[model samples]
Target chain A: MNFKLWVKPFENLAKKDRFTISILWVAMVLAYWLITTAGEKKFFPTPLQVWQGFAALYSEGLVVHIGSSLWLCLQATVISIVVSLVIAYSYPIPLLRPLSRAMSQLRYLPLTGITFYLTILVTNARTMQVWVLVIFMSLYFITSLLAVIKDIPQEEIDHARSLKCNRWEILWEVIVKGRFDYVIDVLRQNLAITWMMLVTVESILVAAGGLGVLIKNSDKFMNHGRIFALQIVILLVGLSIDYTLNTTRKSLFRYSKFN
Target chain B: MNIQYEEKDIILQVENLSISYGEKVIIRDVNFIERNVVRKEINQGQVVAVLGRSGRGKSTLFRALTGLVKPSSGKVLIPDYSQAPSNGMQPAKEVEEGDVGFVDQKYTLFRHKTIYDSLTFALRKSGEKGSEKKEKVMKYLIEWGLEKVKDQYPNELSGGQRQRVAIIEQLLSSGHYMVLDEPFSGLDIGNIQNARQSFKLIENGHDLNTIIFSTHDIELATELADSIYVMGYPRLDDGSLGTVGTIVRHFDLKALGIAWRTEFTQDHLELVKEIKSAMLAS
Candidate 1:
């Protein structure tokens, strides 16, 4: 790996917004230190204690919890994408439009409440919760897809037709080309939301080990420090996931107008 | 109205073609035979203008000609429809391969796509390969005065620039039968001239297609049309839009109006002038 490639973006960032950006960074660090230190005894251990906990957790099969949550989120997200594509393609047809719209509106209901309500119907609450997680997020994904498709200009369609492109070719070529920027934009904005949904579902529904389970179990004994430390881990994990997704989207959609 | 062709062959024959939206009929029983259509056949080398007032169905006529719209009652037959319509002229059904190029009225560039990508997409669809597509699309862009704005997105360009991009895109596609819907609307003189130049190049360079378009500008129509079809008039009692005043004037209005007294405004007054003068003097 060329360390220089990694350093170039920081160098440009420094030149562009050096003063305000550095000040903001320093402020954030100071704020984090104070919050973690002040709550060291009751809620969080000291910064040093948190570090030691991280070191200790690394050897104590913490990997299982991390891996499981990561796997579930990935699974849920993939399911969401497929479901979204189905909704997008189906909703445009006259017969399915009303049903798709109704389902999309229902997605706004509180996830926890829906999970609890659905639990009565299914024998296994965890499985139902996972499916519900996928379905709920998929509704949002479908809405975004619809917006992207609808926003494509009619001229592109006409141009495609004049060129003798079949209906399918028009969809794949002009319409897709026209609205690709919005699709990438929607994906970028929703990466964090997907992770948040994953953690929320895992925390409330999963019987097995996950970061959520650790936090919940720690909460039972009122071990506030461990709960706070678990949250830090979750935050870092969510950030890493978001960063990876954004970078990938930016690279893939480089030809898109937004770049 | 019956259309008689003396010598010119009818390229597009619209027999009693009428269009309606719900209950209101927009144009009814329109009839005409274009002159020199056989001898002056475009061979894909001519540009024709369809000029009319707003709401007169100029765009509708273009769509009807291209079979995008189903006429209420009539037939549109493209006589001598080219076997290999130029590339990028996909209609609902694959008739013969009569390609038609369309520049939509709206500024329909993909807002998120860079100029490079937009042109690339159009060129690739036209079966242009490798560096040829790039060279041709870029050549049109430069010729149409889009070199400075080549890297910009649709949103980044001005209205004229965006429209030129749309024009260049269609030009690169290189369809034989080109139909532009008010291509000069909202453009300044220079952009309009540039767009016209680009269109002229397409027609002259590719002599396998005929171009048809609609506009509200009489000047443009007069400048570009090989034969003008002026279509703003009410149907007479006989269920035909009477001859255009210019065409009627050409046919000796006095002789044609002898049978219909009420229709002859000047002749009726001329006959009654002697009696009216005596009454006025008394």
Candidate 2:
């Protein structure tokens, strides 16, 4: 094969595609640098200061804080998901309807404002923090899952029943399998809310070694660079989780693309 | 009137079947002495079609037959193969899964499963094992020309493909009989012809698979059904709604020289007209 012939295909990209691929990241970085360094009395930390703060925090073991926060969030998320699934699936029974209704109404109560009540109930600070996060996140979980469960077409259930599936089989084959992708989507969306509530939860329980505690300590000492750096870390972690979830959902439900 | 078939040939019997929702009766005294009592005998290998307009209880009747809906006072009798306790009587009981395969109007295939997996799941449910399960699934896939899309999910297939897969899945799972609710509603002409061919093939190949599908299309029903059951809203003597759907007419097409290949002649058109009138009659 001639060298030019092989190179011609590679050079066939549109000007717009080339600009987007090469220039978008550089432009974003330049914008960030200008915004952080332009002012005389800096409200935001300079990029150099933020980078140094990140290095200092890393040397002092900030990974422990990140790990603890992530572990707590994961635990609360798994518990809330299981409980929400139970509530949503049992919503049809008349006896459970009132309980579900009560929970739905409770979602309107502000999560952070209820910290004192949770503290009173569970005096141990760490336990109280976990409880608050679980309760806060589960409200959204229950509501979203209830909507998903309700949106399951009756025909799908009847189809499973017609195939000789008993109640449990219908739950597994129809409800779970049918809503698998949507459930992951719901989790991905609600996980952002959970992370937003994490700082509030961990700040209340100062002894808890998490990013929220680090942010709280930084806030108290007027360490603006450390605050900005920790916030950036949190954002990156959240975005990474979201990207992973999105990729998983796409791969698992490739068939949905054709529809 | 009781239309009796020989006991050995009888595949299903709806005995005095009356179904009601609260006080509003949908099928009142389906096979009793009262008015609107439907007495019919379905034999093995017959393609029966129930024709009716919307809300005429055709689907309700099918639901009752398949044991999805509980009848108010009557029962649907299917041969209880599990209970042959040497009483010299093959007792009949309510329909159960593996007894009657049902396909709804929307061809509800498992979205998560591929065509091959769906068939294998059905076979597995019926206790087929290992190579036998794979062989049966492959056989049907080849037989129906579905081998090409065997690994594709239901959403990846066309509407016609989904319907065929639904029918084939039901056939493999529930071998003896199948009930379909509005199986041909949304299908195009090409798909309808394809469906007809599949049904014909199943009927000819399997000696025991009796297909019962409900539809409002008079022409399609008349063409496919060996016997047609016309359901309509019954009217009392005083010009009031009878609160139930009754069989207005039952046509044994074979007796009238109607076959799968029967051309639409003047007599057939007349019969279609009569069925339409009966379906619409108060």
What is the lDDT, from 0 to 100, of the residue A70 in candidate 2? 93
Error of 2 at A76 (Å): 2.2
Predicted candidate 2 versus true structure: per-residue lDDT over A1-259, tens digit per residue: 2335434665666667666656877898869877868888777888777888898889877999999899888888888888877777677667897777678778999865687678678888877877887888778888888788888788788778777788878888877877788778888989999998878888867777899988888889988789889999999999988989888888989765521
* Clash pairs, model 2 backbone: B30-B38
lDDT of 1 by residue, A124-234 (tens): 756665677687777787777777777766666666666556677766676565556566567656656776665567775656667767766776876545666777888
Using lDDT, give the best candidate's number: 2
C-alpha TM-scores of all predictions: 0.66, 0.81
Q: Tens-digit lDDT track for model 2 on B1-282?
A: 123332233467777777888888887656411111121342225788888778878888888877788888878776676787356656667886446888988899888999998888887676767799999989989989899999999888988899999988888887767898998889999998888888887777655667889987888888887678877778788987666786767887655666344466666788899888887784
C-alpha lDDT values of all predictions: 0.61, 0.78
User: TM-score winner among the candidates?
Assistant: 2
Worst 10 residues of 1 chain A by lDDT: A1-10
* CA lDDT, candidate 1, residue B88: 40
Question: Candidate 1 chain B — worst ten consecutive residues by lDDT sum?
Answer: B245-254
Query: Model 1, stretches more than 4 Å misplaced?
Result: A1-64, A108-129, A175-184, A204-207, B1-7, B15-17, B23-44, B51-57, B73-75, B80-99, B106-175, B185-191, B206-208, B214-221, B227-282
* Candidate 1 docking class: incorrect
Query: Residue B275 lDDT in model 2?
Result: 89
Candidate 2, residue A60: lDDT: 72
